[model samples]
Target: MKNQSPIIEVAELFTISENPNLRIFDGRTGPNAKEEYLKKHLENSVFVDLNSDLAEIDNPKNGGRHPLPKFEDFIKTLGSLGIDKDSHVVIYDDKNGANAAARFWWMLRAVGQTNVQVLNGGLQFAENQNYPLSSGEDSYPETDYISGHQDWQLPQIWMDDVKLATQDSGSVIVDVRESQRYDGITELIDLIAGHIPNAKNFPFIDNLDDDGLFKSPELLKNLYSELFENYDQNKITFHCGSGVTACHSLLALDYAGFDIPNLYVGSWSEWSRNEV
Candidate 1:
């Protein structure tokens, strides 16, 4: 089957609600994410917890707060979610796909799942569009999802690599946290403040518009093309707090038809703890 766009609109999802291969997920994160999901979510959507499902959390100094789970564990997770190779998966979160939604999308794409997509504009947009919603959990029969790749196919960089990239004039390291957090003015999440030595600040929220929807592909392409004009795609890396929001920018890049760049999953959480 031909791959679909990484972004899907509410109207299209509504039309395809009855597709037997469709599997919708609510990928929200926060202290009360599950509670919020249990209260209401897209109809027939199963809830996926960020800390438990998408990540293998341990010491922050080790691999940041939300490191990717082991590949085998993630495969089992996919199976438990009823996501087979052919499943048309759609994910959303309340944060306009900036939270765990994009992380889930990236993981699926990394595993060579071409039919997965993130719901454009996320839950609020769906609710505003009057897409059907349901309270409580929805269940589905599990499938043993067979992966095509032995590991993540997408580019990922560790702290040591990122450290080198920061000093390489040919490379660009982008920090996707808010400017204040990047500037060392304020930090509510990670223990430390400020950004990597030479990492450029490009908050992930900039990927959205006034309606909280992603900007036009042409516009995004133009915007990123200008910013990254001097560097090769392979030389660019993106990171954010705990490695979650960085995928939002990566998603934007993919939506803009650019090659997905390297992801620094340790991000600020691990960097701050390890570095000065």
Candidate 2:
């Protein structure tokens, strides 16, 4: 297949209804994503459960909840999805690139797959665009998904480093949870809040609007001016409830053409469990 393809446009992804290269994956799982997707989804898109296929569970002793899958396991999942190394992966969810699409994107980058992108604003945007929808189980021929070299490029910083860097003037951390969650007003996930002490709060929702589509680059530029225009990109780290939504922020930053930084995948979920 010499012909290459980018992610499907919001219009085509829904309107055309079929694209082989544009693999629209339902990266929406939070105990309900699978059921909801089964009920309905963008036509021709495939479903991938985050919990089962994407995670390698960890023991309570190891402190990793939903640990990353082993290399072999990852290869298997890609194979089952009928994706090859060069597959142009486009993952989306009901939430604003939340759910687990960002995680799916991160996992793709972690393995050196560079063509992955999050469906900014996600499923709601598709519907808002008046894209067609279908509800049914679709199957595909099983392809021999070959494993390639592990090209781990995405970085992961630990809580210990983040703690020490709080005093480092040049370092910054961005908490991607909702504003109330960041302010400790809403304690949904972690017992402690106020966002890693001094990390800036930019809820993932800001990346999109009421319609669930991303704002224009100019608007995004002004919104992220303080963070992207002025600071060192590598000095930044992102975190959310469970390390999933944080990637949303990172993806937005990348879209804005700023330096993409490491993600603290342990996030608050794993961080709160630590002594720090």
Candidate 3:
């Protein structure tokens, strides 16, 4: 699959609303998910649940609330969705690709299916553009995807990277989580209340204003470019709990035309499970 960078503007999607190979995934999730999806969504988009699709079964006390799912089972799930190595997948979620879209994007990339991308503004933007939404379920013939053993990629840094960055004083570790979570004021998902050892708190929410619209790309560039002025973009690693919301930062970087960095997939949630 020759996957060109597939970041598309809201206007661009209209050009290919009828491609046979195109598969759009509705990645909206959480308590509001099923209801929101039932109300409205992109026409012909398939639903991929977060608790079901993006997460693995786990004991309640485990570090990960929704851990990564098993491979064979995940493959079976994808196959039932009519997805395969040859498919050009477009995934999106209303929560800025944070909640579940990135999860599907990661799954596609993990399987060597490079022709996958997260919709920039997600379903809300699509609807705002007056794009059509359908109440009917998306139905397509099932695909029997012949699985290839993929070179498992871990383009992630661990606490080690954090420690090294702290000691050596080279690149910065930016936490893309909320400020409350960063300040040790709230312990939503982890044992420890504080952030990574020496990381800076640059919540992804800061990238947006009150309207839920992202700030101007130039403004974002001016803001973050100064914030990360001392470091090369590749040397930086974007992360959030279980490596999900961090994609918002990755998206932010892309919006700024900065070099995309490695993702620490297992963020603080995974880190909290480890013993020093």
Give the per-residue lDDT of model 2 (tens digit) for 83-111: 77666677788877765787787777677
Q: Give a tens-digit lDDT track for model 1, residues 64-96.
A: 999999999999999999999889999999999
Pick by TM-score: 2 or 3, better one: 2
Shift in Å, residue 179, candidate 3: 1.5
Backbone clashes in model 2, listed as residue pairs: none
Colliding pairs, model 1 = none
Best by lDDT: 1
lDDT of each: 0.93, 0.71, 0.72
Worst ten in a row by lDDT for model 3: 150-159
Question: What's model 2's overall lDDT?
Answer: 0.71
User: TM per model?
Assistant: 0.98, 0.86, 0.81
Winning model by TM-score: 1
lDDT of 1 at 251: 94
Off by over 4 Å in 2: 1-8, 14-18, 59-66
Q: Which pairs of residues clash in candidate 3, taking residues 3 or more apart in a chain or in different chains?
A: none
Where model 1 places Cα greater than 4 Å from the true spot, the runs are none
